[model samples]
Target: MGRGAGAEGSWPKTARAALSGAGGRGDGGGWDVTVGGFWCTARPSGAPPLPERGWQLRVSAAPAAGEAVLSAVVRVLAADPCGFRFAAGQECLSVLDSGTDEPGSTGAFITVHPADDAQFQRLAAELDRATAGLPGPVLPADRPYRAGSRVHYRYGAFAPPAEPGDDGEHRPVPRRPGGERGEDARGRSYRTPGRGRLPFGASGAEAVTAAGATAGATAGPGTAAGSGAAAAAARRRRGGALPAGRYAVTAVVRQCAQGGVFLGREASGGAEVVVKQARAHPAAGRAGADARDALRHEAALLARLAGQGVAPRAVELIEQEDSVFLVQERIAGQPLDGWVAARLRRDDGPGVDWAEAGPVAHGLLDLVERVHAQRLVLRGLSPGNVMVRPDGTLRLVGLGLAVETGRPAGPAGTPGYRAPEHGPGRLAPARSRVADPAVDLYALGGLLFLLATGHDPLLPEDLPRARPVPERLGRWLALAARTGGTARRLAPVVLGLRAEQPRQRWGTARVRAALREDSPGRTDATRPGGNPGTASRSDAAGPSAVPPRPRLGGPRRRPAPAPPAVRRSPSDTTGVSGA
Candidate 1:
């Protein structure tokens, strides 16, 4: 029979009643059963309005009786719906099975494409009533199977083919996917087996599991299909955004070279969330795999760091067809740069005053120390990676790039904030270039310099003058330009932390001790109250200060090799709390 025009008035009364089982496919006395009366639509949550003359229903009968029922449904449902007057590939249906196959009995699965919500409700009511009369158990209508879960299908006895008519020809039946007629060696007509086999069991009946073929499959309900960047792109072309799964994009947060960052709202709950997407390079090969691997690594690290409270909580890692999405809890604060700008915008001009920024600097260090205590390294510690909370306290975010200490490091922090060891022409051999706690300390020192001088330490103009400040006992001339007691008090410790050689730099324990005045490591001499004109003979060559005898390439006192497992926390005296 030709497919209908989809208008209710044009639908034959007999066809409508047949759908309700007045003379259902079961009544036709065939093993292949046709279950109808399901109603769904192509509209995803928050999707734009479908095109005019949007959707239509099409029917696909099994090529022959006793075919795999699950395969038939998939091929039918996945078939081009546009041929029946629907908006081509734009339409999709959410199928729910109401069949009860107990022992020797079998039933059917219902596929629906309702025009609207009211229509869906009505169709669901009628389905429940119709299935109730059958001896099989009644499956609830609204309880559609979840995506990525399994389902079982059972085929009935096969019916014999219809006899040839007076024309001596049997009715034509469509071939299974990839099955075709070919000539045998004898030139006799023969059928070649298709590429795929029926994933069935030994018995006439077999369980057919639906691998992420449900309504929510778009958000990756199945086992990950190998970095689904291509699938994500297809969905974006169909709809303007990624497929609806758990979170729905609400607003664009920011756009970058990698991809776009968006603010999304959870579908189950209206809570606000942040969604960051990264699109793979269009070039298909090793490059695509590398991009996917990078994205996956970032998601995994952020997920692990989420518990440590220093980074944003990782809500979900969604791998779309052509992109990867990382959904995180919305952090209610601005970037460190924004906070600094706002502070300086107030009557205070140019540089960040030490009084206002010193505590913030301490808070950031304390947090980083906490992260290091967990045996993790904060590889990205630039101003862009830090945030100032509503309470004026500091919290670090973007742990996506952080890796375990001692692991071979990937790329380092943005330009000026990274340590010299992480910069070009490092003294350490490439094989021994593992990340260390010293890098974190070095970045913290650069941050201190920026907060004090309102300038990056590595800026080309300042590099010439800043190179000598690290070795000098006097206040850094750049920091001295701001001229505050707080600045002077902070200068010595900053220099100690920013030392070119990791071995000469102060450990977290030493820095904390200096801040608390509990250390005899020149803290007293470095304080503004102590003599500053000429450094104390002991101060200039102390272990925490400049080494008594400077060495080329590395420190005079080489640090012991790190442990094979977790490296010792930088703060050996007092342990910092974990995330």
Candidate 2:
């Protein structure tokens, strides 16, 4: 295919040559086009001469493959090439009769100015064919892409756009008559099951209210306030909002710039699930990959750790239009922070009782060991990402920020839980730092401190501060008074783990040893700083220490000769008292 400067702009020579059929099509084909980036943006109305031409494609390739696609499109339509304007990487494509071109600040793309409806249809069809096999869906040239089956919005908000002359009251979009179903890209049929349809354009809050009214009407008066909460979860076995109509969104758990996390239920089964939506090009970047790539990474990680009981199990990944959704098992627990706060509230004391906190601390330690054993660093290990079950077991959630050991660490993670080395902080530059297990260990220390005292180390008055500082006598004394020796006993361990320098932080082996020694079952001699002499006295006074006495008048048999003691190494503590 020959190339020329079309309406968009001068095409890149490299991109033109790459698509000139010089490289064959197929794996070995010389399809060596380097795509700098690809995205879509809204086009201004009126200038395009057609209302349907409201969006345009942005493609940045060294050889300018976008122009080649546009060229093919024009040839197929038998349209004039001047009607189109192309922008190579970071350049704007000028609009006809417009004062200025759309800014190319967000990257390069091709803009088409179709003169009529016939040209618009031809353009959309050709562009879709040209980019059909790309990573994401063929966008801009096609109609707006909806994420899930029933919901119109990509983030699973039930609000549909209000119809004209509706007086601003939110209303559900009417489904086609006959309860017709539609198929997704995967050719699976799906439809909304219930009579109540979601309002596609309503505000998120309104959409949430509609969903609650649909599902939470049966909840009692006591639960009326929390009816919209995720706790009122149930599964549907049929049609719903998600692809294949397999899951229906009940509540949106969290929403952020990246995307929203929804509490959904299985359409076929009654199990509750969590659906995490990832937009195509999230505002926030993750190691250069888009939110979709990050969600895929998280799904793979969850699959790898499945059945370990430390992380949520991956269910399935659904790709709809320009968004990706990850459906995972909904953990039946509360956030670690809330769990701690609830215990603190119930107790009359300033901090949680050590009896209640110790088990949680140990469970967290075990979880860390399991994750480290897999060579995965829980980069975002904050209390908010941890879930504590009623049975006292712990599970880690939100593994999107996790990275493999030795991978380049990015400026992602909770501020208070992040370590110094993984920084764009005073100690290190923001970039070029590699992931290390010590980062998680550092967070673990802060987490333990939170459990012990119900106060985050990030607080100004906490003993083990998130930032590095010289150990202050006053801070230690304050911690002792608050935790009543529970946190005091673990102060050295926490200090070692939270050391500003990664190398000075305690390793897994040392932490395990310290925790084992301080276990509740250990005797005085085995406890740290316990008096060794008191061990024999405690043992003699204990029920297990005294020998059994003859019960009857019958002559008591002489005590059997004691067995010979076997010498053992220091490491062999089996059957030995306080070895």
Candidate 3:
């Protein structure tokens, strides 16, 4: 049969009957079975059948044991001899409370989509082998199988291939008697509960209430039907918002081409949460990159960083129609830029208090260092991406652009804060293809400069020219002219981190050491006469103490090369510009 044979109106009666049986409505199709200690549900993709990639197998495991089973399944599939091309979609599975009010256990659902019938059989065989010694019943074909909902992590493509002459427009599916199924904006089919039916595993008073609501809605106008219609209209007005029952969106935090960030409250406990949504195929800079993949990558990274307290805690990932939602604990804080701007507005001096910014700078360094230690680089670190909590600690947000070390450095991160080596500047021609932590260091320098002087280091003209400074600070004096007394002392250290060349940039270790030198209780021991409290006669003269400067680009004598066994110390105390 041709690929388009499975189009909506063209589906054969046999196929429709088979799909109806697989819907898990007790039509004598099949029942859930145990495989390797996990509940397995095998069903049709509900997509128009292509020559290949038409079957889905869902595996459910107890919350405590989900990770282990998921890993085992991945390993087994990776080593499959049949070269089964498949992907796993992950989600949290919850069973509603029964009449007895007994607590139910939460679990994970792994939905696997196989390329074809041959691969599907191979996958089943391999799974059996992987869980051979485990204590569970073997897979059987007699029971009804149902599909899953609210997918969180998608490892590979599960949608059918686009057919020739396809317009990518959504076409509604024919609804069944008790439930509804339809295509989303992106032409992906999804099933949702109808008025009379509750979700799978729902029972007791919940089911009764749902049935009662349905009955009332059908009783005609001037009754409950009028109110039901109003409710349905409200839902349609919500449009692409999250599913209604789980979360109630209160406000929108940010909206971009990629998606929107929403402030919501959980229905279960009324706890505030942040919901970040990613549209199916938003515009992107890199070819083949989409918002879906970025959101999925971020969720995986958040899962890895859980318990570290540096990033927001991931609540759950929900796949609702064409958009994906990532729910996280609401962080109670303001953006770093807003906080700095507020402090600057209140300060009588041109610059902020160094005592306040000093600790913030150290906190940023520590957070970035910990991220790098895990072999990840935060390519999007900027004043906007960092948050200052109520307790005066820092947390890194906007981690969607982060890439692992040694991977190709794509066009990611905010413009001014991005490193020259990673951007499309003259230096990019010779830039390394793989990403590294140096990019983050460059942004760190810019952030610190802003914190100290209330100006961006990238734009030298923004630096204040009225504030007088000692000439000994070198090339950085112009940049630090407006900084506070204590902040001026760290100007060289900040400039060193913002060097144009990656090789010329200061590493985290050197930057930390410089901050320690100017830390509280530390004395300037490098001054002449070993005096910690007094300046030399030359320093007392201020700007006049500086000697006439040599012109740039003039012929200059080169220093002799150092001996092979001897190392030369840096002329600049910051160790960033001396070489």
Question: For model 1, what is the C-alpha lDDT against the true structure?
Answer: 0.44
TM-score of 3: 0.49
Residues 14-38 of candidate 2 have per-residue lDDT tens digits of 3354344432332233222222222
lDDT of 2: 0.48
Candidate 1: tens digits of C-alpha lDDT, residues 452-502: 545566533334455453654222322243334344445656776777766
Distance from true location, Cα of 389 in model 3, Å:
0.7
Worst 10 residues of 3 by lDDT: 96-105
Q: What TM-score would every model get versus the actual structure? A: 0.47, 0.52, 0.49
Q: What is candidate 3's lDDT per residue for 406-457, written digit by digit as tens?
A: 7877656666578866765544543556777778887887787667656544
TM-score of 1: 0.47
